[model samples]
Target: MTLQEIFALSPIMLAFGVHAQLSKTTQNSTSNVKEEDVEVIRIVESRIQRLSSGATGLGLDSYETPQSVSIVEDDTIANYQLDDINSLFEHVTGINIDRTETDRTYFNSRGFDITSMHVDGSGVPFGDIFVGDMDTAIYERVEFIRGSNGLITGLGNPSGTVNYVRKRPENDFAARVDLTYGRWAKMRAVADVSTPLTESGTWAARAVVVHQDKESWLNLYGNNRNVVYGVVDGQISDTVTVTVGYSFHDNNAEGNTWGAVPQIYSDGTQADFPASTTTAMNWTYWDTLNRNAFAEVSWFINDDLNFTSKLNHINYEEQSELFYTYWNTGLDRQTGLGLLGYPGKFSAKDDTLIWDNTLQGNFNTWGREHTFIVGVSLADAQTSDLDSAAMSGFDVMPAFAGWTGNEVSRPEWAAPTEAGFADIKLNRYYTAMQLSVSDRLDLVLGGSFIDYDNEGEAWGASTSTTEDGTSPYLGFTWEAIDNVNFYASYSDIYQPQYYLNEDIEPLGSAYGRSYEAGVKSRFENNFLISLALFRTEQENLYEFLGYDDGDGVDDEDYSDDFTYALYQGITVASNGFEVEVSGPLNDEWSLIGGLTVLNMRGENGSEARTHIPRRTFKLLADYAPQWNEKLNAGVSVRWQSEVYSETTGFGRITQDSYGLVGGYASYTFNQQLSLHVNVDNILDETYLGSVRSEQTFAGSPTDYSVTLRWDF
Candidate 1:
């Protein structure tokens, strides 16, 4: 069918499906129905399932997984008013969000960076500058598996893996709309609708739309975002199902700062600046666009075996013009007049395709029941030539007097030039087996073989390389008692490097090992508690040496020419402990909380990883009065220990320990309408939100939002 015809027939299709379903329930009427229609009706009446797909790739319960797993469901998203995927990380245990750049965000897990991402168990390329801008409204839930996950991710950091499960079409008709208004002229609107598309109820469709426009606390900074997502699902037969989806997103921002305010002034004294201080120029801006499409097919051969396949395609583009102010020479403590600003333009386009196929089954071996899975994946990624340019002799800004938040005209420059291009392809084959040695004990074994080829050009130099290796994985679980379980797992993973080393050659990939052990407890399946200890070690780690050249000539610095170099052969280690509790405390009260203690250092026993905190805690609870079914209230608190920046000859800058408190309340006036009010940073604490070698970003202050939602 044509696109226009499909759009016009959607409502009619939904209404017909609902009417057909209702006709079957008439008591006095004898109407003959098709066999397939009967089956579809029965399936549509079943309750929703909340199993974790990313935990083990076996569709097992969270408690049954051998590793530490956390799930943030749809209810949690609405209760906390988490608008985007990045906001959800703040509440997860042992995970930290680092805003290193205006358009990029890094998720730090247990002192390691989370570089692997998946959608519905299908691996995809990472490192997108606009990944953090993804809206969570279209996702059913997010699943996180902590510790080594090489068995499935193939090539990635050992820290963890994140899976975003998109919402599927509903068997019955449902629709919802939300409108929100908040501080700093923030406005947001979201709409979601789902319904059956065929009379037999075998086909279903869902669509979601979102729009947001907001201004930040930083001087003259603002952003506008728009998103659209749609999906179609069909049960072709009793044992076959198919799904297809597409998503589009665009974000544009003006007056974005390339870096935060300077941390220290000349003379070695820390600089004190207002929270509204900004490093952005009036003409500086950043924009990004992303498009994605995916399809999946599942065949249930029998109760004992199943097969599935998934394919995905993605296209992303980003363009920006930024200005950076650097203190080339030591600033005079008294004058603060030693800073110089430079401007540059950058644009990049990326396209990727991924395909994954798998087969799993249950069988009996040696009189023991076991589960086995085999899978293969392929990925191809390509980037267009990067277009870039720089303007010399641009006027510099003086920081001694502070910023005035006034508009500044940009300087005219020369034409842009093509810098480089790159292409990467990866192939992986993996398998895993779960053996039930006895009723109370189980063992899991898995491994993957990866082959990679990369070709690129940099600084007019052509480069091509190929690498292949094997990653092994193992895990086991033992039921210590009826409601308690003990688990342990280990894996070997690697990370590919793209930068040239001190020898002016591309660095070899780094290798790492992860080990973890934990205890999990369940009380009546409604409450859960878990405690885990983990340690990780890596060799030949890559580290960025900054723009300064050892010689005193500023012109040779990497920052001036946009060239990057890396230092290798550095060893690093991290060990940490975590405790988490979630679910209902009772019929009236429900709570979710966690605590983490971490210690990370270099081989020489120095705290080289400064962005991660040594201690962190989070707590959120909700209460509903037995006498009032229409009202509910909740409160949350978060705390983090001191964190420092990378150490330099000038010393280190630290963000002191701090805490924030927030609360929310909701009232349901009727079955179809509700109102909610949320207040964040209720205590109005002032602290540093993020830090870099040269800049620091302040946390947000007290803010309030009101939302009205309607369902039909």
Candidate 2:
């Protein structure tokens, strides 16, 4: 379908009540509802489950929460065949992924980078530098909050926050197995089992194992991955519960590239390369391993009060031997003779520990019910890196006319040396209170106090710093009618910088503030629609002026050997609006759609981060016809506006507007067996996956997958 048709379908579907077979399923009493209709509704509701207390600590639903929230459940993951975090983020609203390299990816939202991520409401470290691709088999659902979350995370950026909820052991005994095969010589298998350990069903254990091997569209690239996860839940007494879990993930990839393909040639003209072109050699590789352990305890004091404690630990390691190609003298259009290669070997290790405690309760005051929450958290992390390089000559590459990946041979490496080291500690105390001022209005107040410290060295430079600060949050919600709510919120956060100034000193810290207002409505048949407007301001951001040559003067001759960077602080602001609609259109159709528009500028009235798209739209829908109870089908569409990046010699690198189409179908043979088929890029559209002044990468072509599942 075309973009115009997709945009117009939203209102038409809601107004006309298309496919009116399941309209009576929403009634409080199922007296007139059919047995099959009731079952369909139940399954739909479970697939699109809602979260309680995802934005604030007062346990408010999406309609009552003052911030915008979105969730992706297990059913959606399986239907789309999303195996890693990179693929999952593509379906989330207002999110963009930057595929800078084959093995590393960066995420951004609202014209800023996302720096905060949590598991079960507890903060953890996240970034391309800390870990590689994360597997999604251990998570039941992922929640997103589209604004500054100061009350939950003490120090962070204003882009957004992500929370991953884990899958737990069930009270019953069940098992499932799946085998999948896809294009590009890809194969996968998964096994999951859950059972009760006692006759009383008070204790339970669950385990999951996964293995996958796949080849990429790029030349000479492939990967092998494995995952193992296990969890146990026990009831110590009628009022107490305990849970523990562990997970391990390993990924090994060959022929990994360090950067993207060059975008410009020597004559300041654009260069065109095939989608299958790559700069990696046959001997290059990147491997990573991640391990996580967590434990939790809960106590139910009464119906209105409760307490919980959690502990989490993580260990991550990575090793890579790669080659980076650069065009210092620019590539010749006829011969491609100016390319040079730099080979390096590197390893990294990261360790983290976190502890959190929370207490919450409700009370009666002034003829109204009020709720309060208090929590404390402590986190410590350490990271170290080692590096090595070839001692002899391995700098020139053969001509690109008839070049193959096997042309270059492995180089001799030198002794490894310490590249960087860091130790970070954070302690935070937070509190929140929700007051029901009247039958039509509510108020929320919260804040966090944080103490942060870091000590380490990076590339022969000291990175030690210390800071302490407080972040504040406030919000209000008013019920305008029977099923409508109007809300507004304000919050702020702080982040310490690692960049150095001309005098060789740290740049202190940066601060950010967010303001938002929105309206939400719940229509008949459980349909939800929301419209939101937001503004964010960030100050003290570092900007580069020039490279210093130790003589207090800017010089191009020492560009490769500069001692320090001349930096200054600047302020930036971003304004945006979003509209989202999700729910079942009728008994047979379910839909999720969103549109986002953004504009960002610096203090000088110039556009900032021009490489990010200014507008994006996403739509997904599923159909389960009553005529065929055992068959289902779905479709997905995504579109984005133009983006451009500027460079000194290449003028501008631009990527025009583009759209993608995908679809899936499934058939159930019996109660214990099923088959599914998925097709991606059905339209066979060609586009750039990433566009930057330095380099660019091509997106994937049409692909297909088939899966067989069994349940017992």
Candidate 3:
């Protein structure tokens, strides 16, 4: 049914702001409502509600939107003891993680790469190999939306988008602390405190601090980190609200690997490395530092009308010193010889600023209630990098068979020389309207106009590129039953290309279109189920061709170094289906599960995209017995199909399918204290975690941890 009619069925839960508070006492003090019953309702609502800012400009339920959305809230994160954003994505639905390196990772959806990210609804830029080193303690929840989000994020792939919602100051005083210990000497501590600054509880502040230190499965590789965050929230007046926050993170680590272990051996057979094996040297190091400051302001004109704006500034830097090896030179299958090494030091920095403004409200047209939203956003990002040689006496290690992790010494690097710099700016304006067509149907129409510009230095020369276009979106939703809704949507996206061809001509821009249809249903107001089918077509996709240089170097032009002239485009089509079920099925049990299947091909009907799986499944469940209120247990399973990639010397390497099983148990000592134990990879399965163009990374073995949480 229409949005207005659906809310009318449950005003106590769907109403907003001052209007909803008036009847809070009446609902809580009802004659039939008991304390335990109220607690169950609160738990269910906190875990299953569809209130989010990512699905639409205004908070909309899953049945009201035409896209796929999944959220990982604070309760789930704490229960699972997820340390960071990277760990959370591993359990999300319809998404695949490609951990090419220990610290760097990439996400793929529907055979396409996801490059769009937002913090508190403001856009953030992304790079190829940069790690988004964020601590999860400062976030309220992480939201993932599938399919094209061009209506809000401007130019990007038609894959998906991610948004991080920060924790806000509460009106009451609260404090919490957690201590955790795990294998590999891993130890972590976190503290969170929120308190009101005014007697009326209109002004408040919150602070979160975390410290973590851990040793890795790989030899000589470990991590040490420190994070601090603080936020202030104020109800300046009855109509105004404001929030400001700042966060800082620093990470130090040793034995950072530049690439994966060698996959090809001397006898032409694929080499298998032990889980604890590593090519990283004891003296190698990589460190990162990130700082962010943000502010948000909102004005509530009425229950149905509101205006919001946000500003964010981010600064990030990374420094590294290392020595790496490659088999680009043909390997000697008989002697395990013929490898080349390079020793270098590098540093990079990125600075960004983002601004966003939005206005949303409800209005009546032709005696029907409708919702409308208008927004404008701008982002500017600048990056610079430099590289230099290592210490004078430290030359590239020449002997691969006689080297060990203990033979390396710390490097004293020389001053770096300026390599390049870039400046990118993006501007976008968009509007959307949700119209109630009939008692059983709703229509959504929106479009975004984008202007993009880039200026940088390439190959020792100054360069600039500019492009602009409009992305259009349309969707329709029909109520098929009391709680089941069917929806269909179509969206288009455009992005500019900055590469030059062999003839020194700039290539054409990239374009893509997505079509999706889905059905969603909610049972008992506590459980949710959805199934979706989607098809996407992309053109002008770029790839670099290996242009053999006379020196036997595969893709390099040794003379002028590898240039963009070798990159060209090809057409691709991808189709996929996804299914998900999540939330509580009853008062004593909860569950979450998902499955995905994909088919992607090129112009010649050949399988496209290497190092990515074609199918994936995940499940997590928890149960608390009614006979015992102090004990709870959980279990999880994850599986992925086979994947393969071609090598220059070995021809082709395939990784067989594998599955991992884990479980958790918790004992509640009282209302304010609890202890939990968790285990992962219980079977200790040995499998390839990720495959790169020339190498493969191995997965971790069995591990366990214990956590104690105190809330006051």
Q: Largest lDDT belongs to which candidate?
A: 2
lDDT of 3 at 357: 73
Best by TM-score: 1
lDDT of each: 0.73, 0.75, 0.72
Using Cα atoms with residue i matched to residue i, what is each candidate's TM-score against the true structure?
0.91, 0.89, 0.89
lDDT of 2 by residue, 1-712 (tens): 4222432453321111000111112223333556645433322222233233477755566788888887777778888887788878877778877776788776778877777788777765334222456778778878888887787777646778888877776657888898999998989998889897876565778899999999988888888899999987655554456677888999998888887677777777766778777888888899999888777766645546667777677788999988777655677888888777767789999888777777877789999878888988888778998988656325677776345777667888899899778888878899989889999799988988888888877666677888898889999999889789899999885876666666666677779888889998988886788898999999986665554544655343333333455567779899899898777888998877688899999989999877788998877788999999899899988888998877667567777899989978999999999999999889888777676446756778898999999989
Enumerate residue pairs that collide in model 3: 266-333
Error of 1 at 211 (Å): 0.4
lDDT per residue as tens, model 1, 181-215: 99999899999999989876678899999999988
Native-to-model Cα distance after best TM-score fit, residue 472 in candidate 2, in Å: 0.4
Candidate 2, residue 305: how far the Cα is off, in Å = 1.6
lDDT of 3 at 599: 90
Clashes of each: 2, 0, 1
Error of 3 at 400 (Å): 4.9
Off by over 4 Å in 1: 1-47, 125-132, 405-408, 461-463, 548-561
